[model samples]
Target: MPLTDAKARNAKPKNNQFKLFDTDGLFLLVSPAGGKWWRFKYRLGGKEKLISLGTYPEVSLAQARARRDEARGQVADGIDPSQARKALKAARVQNESTFEVVAREWHTKFTPTWTPGHAVTIKSRLEFNVFPWIGERPVNEIKAPELLMVLRRIESRGAFETAHRIRSICGQVFRYAVATGRAERDPAADLRGALPPVKPKHHSAITDPEKVAGLLRAIDSYQGSLVTKCALRLAPYLFVRPGELRQMEWAQINLEAGEWNIPAEKMKTRQPHLVPLAHQTLEILRELHPLTGTGKYVFPNPRTSKRPMSNNAVLAALRRMGFEKEEMTGHGFRAMART
Candidate 1:
């Protein structure tokens, strides 16, 4: 029978591999591989045509019968199933662009236009966070809610700023995809006003000049590592971000000139900064010279000179001094000096 409606239960398996029947002038074969397939044999425009329907039991006998009827109707209308499947496949290939492939293509095209450091920043964030999440999803199919889910994960970790930056990069990739006709619209668009606005957590700032005098006075008495002491002294005088401060290389500083040159690669504003060192700042550097003078970084990790110290080194030093994160961070010195 072309349509077998029997249900199997506690029964022995059939060894017969070929189960065949005819429906609507089409021969249907159910192979031992469990493939319930359709084949149409006819002269199409004076050429013989053979078409496969699909696999079974997924395509049951009843479904195959319906498809067989549909194919006969298509043949009557002078349409070919094989040719139609080819067109459908081509359309799917055109519409579907994997996130990683499109992202890298966009990155390759746009990185040339960005400043070197900014380009690295964009790439690092994507590789570590974004790629692992949506890299396999089709670019056109990524919804704003899905994007929100990714950003919210970062936000939950208290990385509010990083969440914002990643959101920006995702937006950039989508824009590139749109320009190249890989995607229809930038789902990350209008997300600027859509995502949560970043608010730097309120920290305990030293507002009183007297308190600043006391904090500086207390800093002088701390018996910490020379690297940390120097880091503390320089934090107030140089007032660079923690990353810039930690990544400070010997190649960028000139102790003789009483100047520290922050490289373009390390700065938040994407430009090198020049700090005219106070005598006190120079003294701290001079004291630490014998310890780290041969290394790549002035404050390299105690365990490695090729790599910078962990970002938390200075902050951890502060915590040991009974200062909580909200009270005074290494970067808080900048906020304090400004006030």
Candidate 2:
């Protein structure tokens, strides 16, 4: 007889396990420990076989019958229902392993070796440029043309350099996917020379000694935050990269030793650098000391002491001093020193 909801729910466990048979090979197996399991029994290739449907209360009577009917239909069509279930599960797993998933895994694994700023830039590039386009696709199935379409989108904006950077970053991600056995090959590799090369633009500087001296006098008499004015003054003297100069920590400066030590992670070459302090530079530092000496950064943000000054602070100061973008920039200090 076919089981009903009442019969199935009211069924009790016995000292030994027993089955309550329903029609169409569906039954409820009540175990000795009061556990109820719904199971399906069928014959295939002239041999009887059985498979689990679910649990009693969880599967319920009607749901168990539906599942049993579905499985019997598969057996009638000469397909092993268990094997079909396994194949469906494998396909689902494959669908979940997407390019974004693998790329994020790779990013997390290698982020420890990169500087914090570089790590943020890498993540930002992928999130803004790559992820929205191809992130949901399975890593193993992504093709070369698909990746090129993504890069071409970046190129369409006249950002040739940014396009090239995204391509390199994608290449690294694909290589990581390959090394981890998720992808077959890097599609980015097939895109060699596919984008226009970026032209090198030099920072503009006032190379004439008299103009340089004039710029210095302007900085000295500049009307700005004392911290920004100090940074402007030190830029020409130290000639460190603008980033390194802005991110300088008070702990790295040795006023007594007359030097500022920049750690390797902060430098572009990833090597530690030492800048010897001149007497004038030392005097400027000593004068600025009392104001910002208590903070972690030598030039902390005016709004918040936790972070260093904005990267635009120096450039904006130069702009305020009547220097056009084409004439001079914060990076111009480096070129000015070199000349």
Candidate 3:
């Protein structure tokens, strides 16, 4: 006889396991240990076969019957329900392994070898440019044209350089996916010369000694944030990268030793660098020490002492002193020193 909800729930376990038959080959298997399991029994290819539906209380009487009817329908159509279930599970797993997932995994794995600033830049680029477009697509299924469309979107904004960078980053991600068995091949590899080449840009510098002197005179006369003013003063003296200069920490400087020790993590070459302080540089440092000596950075942000000054602080100071971008820039100090 077919089982009902009351019969299934109230049924007690016997000394041995037994089955309570329900309609359409569905039944409740009450074990000797008081465990109630729902199962389906059916015939296929003129032989009997059985499959598990679920457990009691979890898969109640009506739900078990529904599942049984579904499985029986599969048999009528000559499709084995077991194989279909496996295929569905595999599809779900593949869908969950997306481009964003694999790319982020690759990033996390290699971030330890990269500088903090470089790592942050790469992550920000991927999140802002790549993820929103193709992140959800399965890594294995992404095609070359699809990736080109993503790069073309970046190019549409006149950011030719940034577009090329995004393409390179995507190529790295696709290569990682291939090595890790998530993708068959890198679609980014097929996009060779797909974007315009970025022109090499040089920082504009005033190499003439007379103009250099004029720039120095202008910096001395300028009145701005004291931190910015000090940074501007040190730019000509140190001629370090603007980033390296701005991020200088109090701990890295020694007034008595007349030296600044920059760590490897902050350097572009990933090597420790030492900058010997000149007498003029020492004097500037001493004069500014009273105001920011207790802070972490030599040039702390004017609004927040916890952070370094803006990367553009020196550039903005030059602009305020009437220097055009083509005439001079924060990075121009390096070139000016070489000349």
Candidate 4:
């Protein structure tokens, strides 16, 4: 007879473990310790085998019988219920190892090789853009169409170049998943030319020696704050990036050695750079030293020494002196010196 809920609950343990039989090979195994577990005994391939359906109360009488019937169906179809259960368990484990989890792992592994700014940018892009859509989904189950939907949202925001970069990053992540046996293929690989092309922007610069001399003369006659004036004068000589020059510190300069050693962390190339100071550059520094030598930054903010000079100060000064942005920018100093 099939076990009723009231009888199963009242069933007590004896001296040893015993089985309370139900129809179709289903039974409740009552242990000596008073534990009641549902079990299904069956024969497959000329061998007898048994599997646990679940525990009493949790599996209940009706649910346990339903699971037993499902397993019996599989057995009739020449399938082993045990093997099918194992396959389902494996798939559940793989699903828990999601795309977001793998992508973040990939980010952590590769961030050490990138600059701090680059690392932050990459992380922010993913967290704000990609993670919300398909992050929780299984990496192996993420098809090309779903990934394309994510990229199209980014492209819709007018960040065409960023969309392309994100696709490349997704490809790297997918390839990493493949190497780790989590995914079969990179879905991003099929997205070639799927986004719009990036437009080229060239920084404007005046490279002629006569024109450069004229620029220097204009900077000298300007009546702006002395800090900005100093930066303007030093820009042409150092030819360092605007950011590098603005963040320059007195500690990095060696007056006796006539060198400016920029640390690797501050450099875009991730290598320390030595700028051999010309006599003219040294003299300019000497003149400005008495005013700002005690501060952390050589070109500290004009109003207060708490921060470095504004990045736009030099550009704004050039505009004040009647130079258009199309003619010369603060970054143009490098190309001008290069020419």
Tens digits of lDDT, candidate 4, 1-339:
667889888999999999998989899999999999999999999999998999998888999999999999999999999899999999887766698899899999987777798889988888988989989989999988999999999988898888988999899999999998899999999888777789977688888889888998998998997778888888888999998999999999999999999998888777899999999889889988999999999999878887888889888999999889999999999998677
lDDT over C-alpha atoms for residue 297 of model 2: 89
What does candidate 3's lDDT look like per residue over 70-140, in tens digits? 99899999988777788998888787679899889999998876788788999999999999999999999
Tens digits of lDDT, candidate 1, 1-339: 343445311112355554355555566554554445556665569888877776656665566677777777777899887787799887776545778778888888866566677778888888888888988888878989888888888888888889998888898889888887878888887567765787777556565788777767767777877787788777778877787888888888788898888766566665667988888877878788888988888899988788988888887887787777777877787787677
TM-score, each model?
Answer: 0.58, 0.69, 0.68, 0.68
TM-score of 4: 0.68
Model 3 clashing residue pairs (backbone) = none
Q: In model 1, which residue pairs have backbone atoms overlapping below 3 Å?
A: 36-56
lDDT of 1: 0.75
Q: Which stretches of candidate 2 lie over 4 Å from their true place?
A: 1-77, 112-121, 207-210, 220-225, 263-280, 302-307, 337-339
Clashes of each: 1, 0, 0, 0
Per the 3 Å backbone cut-off, how many clashing residue pairs does candidate 2 have? 0
Candidate 3 off by > 4 Å: 1-43, 46-78, 107-133, 217-226, 256-259, 263-280, 337-339
Q: Cα lDDT of all candidates, in order?
A: 0.75, 0.90, 0.90, 0.90
